[model samples]
Target: MTGAATGLGLGIAERFVADGCVEVHGLDITPTPDRVVPGLQHRTVDVGDAQEVDDCVEAILTAAGRIDILVCNAAIMQDRHEVLQTPDELVERVLRVNFGGVFNLCRAVGRAMKDAGSGRVVTVSSQVAETPWPGMAVYAASKAAVTTFTRAFALEMAPYGVYVNTILPGTMDTNQMRDSFAGLGRMTGADPESLIAAKRTSMPLGRMGTPQDAANLASWLASDQASFSIGGVFDLTGGELWSRS
Candidate 1:
């Protein structure tokens, strides 16, 4: 699992471990403290770096013998700016980490899965890919790329019994979400709590989603129960996608 050190990624990794996965390897840029999960092994890796990602995958294979499931959840949401104000470097950096990371890992792990003839790849995208909130052009675009690429890749990998799917999560009460909201508030000179409360009220479900909600869906997607699911995008948006009120 990429980005398994925090937020949704950590939730997913925890679920996998709790589900009795023999070995769960978490790859992240941050240093994960020892024994975050009983059998979870943490590797500090910049997913944006292709070489680093490749080496990490190789190491996981060496240690675990096989990678039955891969969860691509490493991403960043930064510089909430309009396109005119967004820097070229920022765009490149976001794309490199958010989309390139997925590309590198999928290529590396997908090759291994192809050789093995069976594997599951569950990518965590965001509802913004389709919903298109302002000030999120770059992040949304990267996720859009991931959504489309995963679908196409799934078709290619289907012949080899590998299933690939994407998950689009809506507003969740994660540290990242809180941080992003705080940052946006700072930019807009608005109270973060007020902004967050407004967001909560905007959700048709009457509450913001939890990391566990996303983790539950991810766990399901990674299981054999989702065997027939392929190249599909699952939304865990708490009906926010349809709410315009």
Candidate 2:
């Protein structure tokens, strides 16, 4: 699992461990800590670098003998800015980590799974990919690319018994979410608390999602229970995407 050092990725990694996965390997650009959840091995890796991702996957295969499941969840949401004001470098960086990272890991691990004749890939996208928001152009675009890529790749890999699916999370209460909102609040001169409260009120379910909400669906997709499922885009948005005020 990429980005497993924190936020939604960490929650998913913890869930896998709890589900009795033999080995749960987590990759993040962040430094590997001395201690993580039991049964999870943390590694420092930049998924945006294709060579690094390939090397890491190869190492996992060499050590674990096989990789049964893969979760491509590494991503970044830098400060929000309108398209015209967004710098070229910021766009490139976001695309590299959010989209390129997914491509690299999926291609490398998908090949291995194809050869093994079976695997499960769960990618975390965002509801914003489909429901656009002002000042989130780059982040939303990157996730949109991931959503489409996963759908196409699923078709190509289905014959090999590999299932690929994406989870679209909406307003999850993760560190990244809070940080992004806080940053946006700073830019707009709005109190971060007010922004968060406004978001909560907008949700049809009356609350933002939890990381565990995403983890539950991801866990099912990664398990045999979802064997017949393929190329699915599961929404864990609490109906916020379709809410009518």
Candidate 3:
């Protein structure tokens, strides 16, 4: 998994360990937690860099001898801003870290999976992919690309008995989400807590989703329980994306 140091990545990595993944590697741009699981390995890596991703994957394969499961969960999202006002550099950075990172990781690790003749790849997308949000055009677009990429790749991998799927998570209560809303507050001149409260009010479930909520699906998809599942975009966004009758 990429970006497994915190937020959804950390939660998913923890779940993977609990679900009996003997050896789980957590890779990210920053140092991972020292609170180590005996079977878990931590590596600092920038998934946006192709060389870094390749080296990391190679190192893991050398140590583990095989790659069986891959979760492309690395992404970055800036506060919602109008497209015209959005800087080219910021847009490029988001796209690079979000979409480009997934591309490089998938290319490097995907080859291993294909060579091994089977693997499960779960890409972390966003509820925004289907339920577009104003001012978050870039993030939604990138996740839309992720979903499309998963579909196309799933078809290709199906012949090799490999499966690729996407997990669409809603607004989750994580440090990342807090930071995101805080950024939005700065951008919009509103109190961060107020914006978050408004978001909670909008959710039919009356609360934001959790990392574990998404991790449950990730665990299922990564296991043999979902062997027959492929090319699916599983949403864990509560009822936020649904229209009320």
Runs in model 3 lying further than 4 Å from the true structure? 34-38
Which stretches of candidate 1 lie above 4 Å from their native place?
33-35
Candidate 2 residue pairs in backbone clash: none
lDDT string for model 3 (1-245, tens) is 98787788888988999988878998888785635656667888988899989999999999888889999998888777888888898888888888988889889988998899999999998988998777889988999989999999899889987999999888898877888888788778999999999998888888888878878889999998996789899978887776420
Task: Supply the TM-score for candidate 3.
Answer: 0.94
Candidate 3 worst ten-residue window by lDDT? 32-41
In order, the Cα lDDT scores of the candidates are 0.89, 0.91, 0.86
Identify the runs in model 2 with alpha carbons over 4 angstroms from their true place: 32-35
Per-model TM-score, in order, reads 0.96, 0.96, 0.94
lDDT of 3: 0.86
- In terms of lDDT, the poorest run of 10 residues in model 2 is 32-41
Candidate 1: TM-score?
0.96
